[model samples]
Target: MAAIMENVTFIDSSTCAILISAFKAMQLKKTGRLVLADSPVVQSLIELTRLHTVFEILPNQKSGIIGIDGRVKFAITIIGPVN
Candidate 1:
């Protein structure tokens, strides 16, 4: 499986563990995207747990008018199946 991390995010061990298991399972299946958002909370947790590089991180954003504050808010599209 392939990891495509982006945005800003992270998760706890309980969550990361399950994801890791899923990743190992998917690796045997087909390559896919593993997007991660810019979430320091989750990122730190992953890091402390020694899983920062385990997943792919893609810190990118597509600029678009989302009626939030004119360039202040950017909507993101996560191209992956969480489950």
Candidate 2:
């Protein structure tokens, strides 16, 4: 599975922390996490939190969708032959 976060605006530090924990959990589960941060403010926050290294930060929603599609295809191929 994959996560697509678009046009997200965090109002508080707690919310950002919560998302960080969620992203870590997603990573542990081998889930693809993509963030669509077209806003400079959002990008700065992500960079400040160093989450850009943790998740794929895309400039637009289409990129995130493409990323998720690629990941899904890979996962399917990896699991398709399992009996």
Candidate 3:
């Protein structure tokens, strides 16, 4: 998961669903920290997974952050345009 996430900070539609499914599968085990931009794609994924608490939606564009934490074992970033 780290290798997959390490390659990109921005997420386009092509990979969004795949990554979201990966996170959804991990929801039960709490295997990672998901940093999601509050965009339509993310909102849809959240609903699909019904795993709202597992995702940390960026509160503001300026303060958004995405980083890896070994303790969590995985990390994902859902990037969006500045609002």
Among these predicted structures, which one has the highest TM-score?
1
For residue 7, give model 2's deviation from the true position in Å.
5.7
**Worst 10 contiguous positions by lDDT, candidate 1:** 70-79
Off by over 4 Å in 1: 1-11, 62-83
Per-candidate TM equals 0.52, 0.47, 0.30
Over 6-29, each residue of candidate 3 has an lDDT whose tens digit, in order, gives: 433454555646656666666655
The candidates, ranked best first by lDDT, are 1, 2, 3
Clashing pairs in 2: none
- RMSD of every candidate to native, in Å, equals 7.4, 9.0, 10.9
lDDT of 2 by residue, 19-80 (tens): 67766666567654433434455556656776566544543333433343333111101111
Error of 1 at 55 (Å): 1.1
lDDT at residue 3 of model 2 (Cα atoms): 35
Q: What are the lDDT scores of the predictions, listed in order?
A: 0.48, 0.46, 0.44
| Candidates arranged by TM-score, highest first | 1, 2, 3
TM-score of 1: 0.52
Name the best candidate (by lDDT).
1
